[model samples]
Target chain A: MGNSVSEVQTADDVLLELRNLRTWYPTGGGVLGGGREWVKAVDDVSFTIKRGETLGLVGESGCGKTTLGRSILRLEQPQSGQVIFEGEDVLKMPAGRLKQVRRNMQAIFQDPHGSLDPRMKVRDLIAEGLVVQGEMRRDERDARVAELIDVVGLRREHLDRYSHEFSGGQRQRIGIARALALRPKFVLADEPVSALDLSVQSQVLNLLKDLQSEFGLTYLFIAHDLSVVEYISDRVGVMYLGRIVELASAEALYDDPRMPYTQALLSAIPGNERASGRARIILQGDVPSPINPPSGCPFRTRCWLAQDVCSELVPPLREVKPDHFAACHFADAI
Target chain B: MADGGATGGAMLLEVQDLHTHFHTRAGVVKAVDGISFDVPAGGSLGIVGESGSGKTVTSLSIMRLIEPPGFVASGRILFRGRDMVGLSEREIRGIRGNQICLVFQDPMTALNPVYTVGTQVAEALLAHQDLDRKAVRERVVELFRLVGIPAPERRFDEYPHKLSGGMRQRVTIAMALANEPQLLILDEPTTALDVTIQAQILDLVRELRHRVNTAVLLITHDIGVVTELCEQVVVMYGGRIMERGSVAQVTADPKHPYTQGLLASMPTRAVRGQRLAAIGGAVPNPLRMPAGCPFRPRCGQAMNVCVTDPGLRNPGDGRSVACWLY
Candidate 1:
């Protein structure tokens, strides 16, 4: 089975691809003749996730990481762009076809407590996805639920318990179990471990890693914490405002960050051991409003090396090193 | 005074064997079980833990802010050599904001909605000091400037909602420091703010601690904040103190498995590619806490002796840990 999985992995690689993706919501009031203002939640994000590889999407709050993940899954329709999943453009797919696409792509939300239904028992919650897809009978669903409970390291007795009855870590496990119910080829874990405690976060992260290997799954892990991203990701994309500034292999990005924003973020994370680099690149000012982001480079407002060229021309995501892409004029200097 | 001796800098607050419990409908939740720590004059201490770790309860107990059904069941709260536990409600009120002030997590809720930010700051000052209207206004503007609030005069008339989240937090800090209290308790002050704003607030706290010579009791979950500002750190879990030591000693050489797991789980510059080493199992319910060690169920190196509830014992050093492994 493992050999077959490895063979399938090589053949059916590149599970999900997004190009020029933009998601914007119209704010209610505007000064210009009642014309609505658009909050550019996600603008021109492009990335791909290959089968069995974890692509971490990292940024601060309101940097559009969550929006990008949602748009890729079509949970929130993109304003414009291409989301090609399994060689099919998901945006162009009809509602009927989109339903089938959902079976392949699932999402685990940030708040486990809020995501799960309060009234439903743990068993029903885990099996709801299967029931919705009409893929199994009641007896089979119950058996699958029991199996999933064990898989997620939850007790079988917890099946009857409500969401509130469990702790934060347990609730997150239930969330993971539910996402895995459909045997999704790709999972969008949007800050899955952010709300859990530090100790519990590690446990959930290990579980996700194990599940990915077992299912040969691809993941788009979105989070704000750089350390977590560095730990779990095979490759990483650093987002600022509404655009990705750096994308590289996890080790490469952490070892040699090209973008100033990425450098600041990396510096912000405390070192595990006493011995580490102490020179922090403290970015000036807060992230500008995405509604009216700074012209050219989105990060130029907070960047230390902002010059006329940076404000005049937006740097493209060009490869500075082998397979490492950075969108900054001074990428070479970094 | 310069050598960090016991003279002059007396103990500002000494909490001995404190126990705070919540009488919920389900059962009596022992939120803060027999925990003891202290905040000396001009010293900053950080209490770090995940949700339901009783870190917040410990602070609330000291402030005498726990509402009905939740009360401090045991322990002595000694503030400036006075027993705070037996103080009357009015007497506690006098000491609450005048000598000891608390800054809450959510700045939006901490400040009243209807009142202007300046008015709130004025009210705090008015509670302790007797000043005329003009003098109060002058003090409020001065505080706004002191906390780095831009356009102090214009901001003085603006309501809480009018200010930005960071600015509102500054207003809260200004209010907390209005009376120049000897001790300031900040409960996750920057947890809800942005990272940049969090950095600013942390810097502000550090600066204020130096300027006022006020001891700080900072309760937060973020370990980075602890390392940045705190001199000493107390690691709590399931309503008990898991470990307590100087930040350097605790972060560098964590004695408790829980503390090590926390440090490990935190994504830092080191741990690369490997999945974060998360401690398995959830924090045990405070209502039905496991006998012996409260953290034994979720502990990575749990042994038979761990089941015999270990108390905080000095391991031949100044550091204290409540783990059998130690």
Candidate 2:
């Protein structure tokens, strides 16, 4: 299990590989149609998720974490990038092939109440994907839906219930069952437990973990909660205003964070036992608008050890330690 | 204030048998049903619970702000030994901002958009105090500074839309502190802010509370926040107090089953990659809560006696629990 976080077998075994991914939303501040500025939501982001591993993505609001998840699934079109899955560049896939790609890659959204359709029954909701993508008979589809409900810790009788009739935790389970209906090799769960209550959050989280192991799934788990991310993730990548600032194993990121942004984020989590004794590195001001980020390092404006050079040059994500990478010019010196 | 419980201190606010109900068309939703607790002077009391747990309603009832479908049906809200349950609207107006202040969740909705942040804070002072316009302006700047808002002079003129989420919350706090109230009620104030911003706001609140010696009534669903900002805590579930004790005792050794579940469910506290011990079942429907214990459906340690409501009883070590086990 420890080896899973530090190293995967090989690049050939990589389930998903993103290369120089750039997803930007054009703002209409300048010209009506032409000279639009980019929000730079996911600016030059890249990462890899191997089979049977969860890579946690974390950042503050508007840091482009959610945008990156949406971009990977192609829910939001990227201006340029390569999302290579199973040796296939999904971004370059034609419409016919892209539809096929969708079957292998699925998403579990944040909102349980809003994500599940109210008009649809629980059975239809779970079997919707299979009905469209599979050649299975009606009874086979029904059997699969029942199997999914049982796998997600719900009873078979629950298939007849409406989504609104279920609790938050149950609704989330239904969402998960729906995502797994197509038997995706990779699952992108975007804040799956954020909207749930504290106790219910743990239930959904545990269910997701159980299903991940049962199905041999790969996940790009995205959230703002550092603690939950650390708990569920093998490796983590910290985002800041549309760029990955730190990438490392969960242990390394928590035990020793090199980037100032990562340090601030770790220190910010309340009730970490060490929180009372430690001095928190509070970042001043709010996250800057993505339309026009700072001159150089996005975090330089809030970095405690920010030097003049920090604002002059963008720091690249470089390996500073064994199996740990941080995007800071002075990462080693720190 | 009944000084019978743990960590003996001057009693600042005491809520006794408070039942705040909502007379909706569906039925009488007992949002807060016969709940009681005590807050020490200059100390913080945390009302920890999930949604529909009556935590928010408790605070609103204290502020005499429950409107329309919701009303405080019966309760004794003793603030400095004064019964505020039946206070007239005119009387509450004088005491609302002057004696006790409230800063609820969603700073955007709390603050007026058209008006500048300065005007909103000044309005609090103008309503309760007899300070002139110039003094009000000076104090507004000071209040902003007290809440750690940068460049108070410049921020004073800025509209609520211009300031960020954390900044708007600071302004909201400044307004709440306009008259230096004896008791400050915060209802999930930091839930909407980012985690870093949340830490900053909580720090500012702790520092301000100590400086002004204002007792705090903090309401939140996150046990982490409660542990950070509170001394005493009351765990609520389905409009009832499931457990009440000092934060130290409860977090260190939670007696109630519900409290134990909440503590174990915290992702930070739980071990990495391990399944959290989540409490099963949702809160009972507010309109049609169970005739028995409200938490029985979700309680892992439910005994046969849970079929009936358990009264609050002392289980030793200066803690009170409402359960059959106690």
lDDT of candidates 1 onward, in order:
0.85, 0.88
For model 2, residues A216-254, the per-residue Cα lDDT tens digits are: 999999999888899899999999999999999999998
Per-residue lDDT tens digits of candidate 1, residues B197-240?
67667767777776778788889998778877778899999899
Each candidate structure's TM-score, on Cα atoms with residue i matched to residue i, is 0.92, 0.95
Backbone clash count for every predicted candidate, in the order shown: 3, 0
Runs with alpha carbons beyond 4 Å of true place in candidate 1: A1-12, A29-34, A137-139, A270-275, B1-9, B300-307, B324-326
Q: Give the TM-score of candidate 1.
A: 0.92
TM-score of chain B alone in model 1: 0.97
- Fraction of true interface contacts that also occur in model 1: 0.59
Question: Clashing residue pairs in candidate 1, if any?
Answer: A202-B278, A203-B278, B292-B309
Query: Model 1 Cα displacement at B270 (Å)?
Result: 3.7
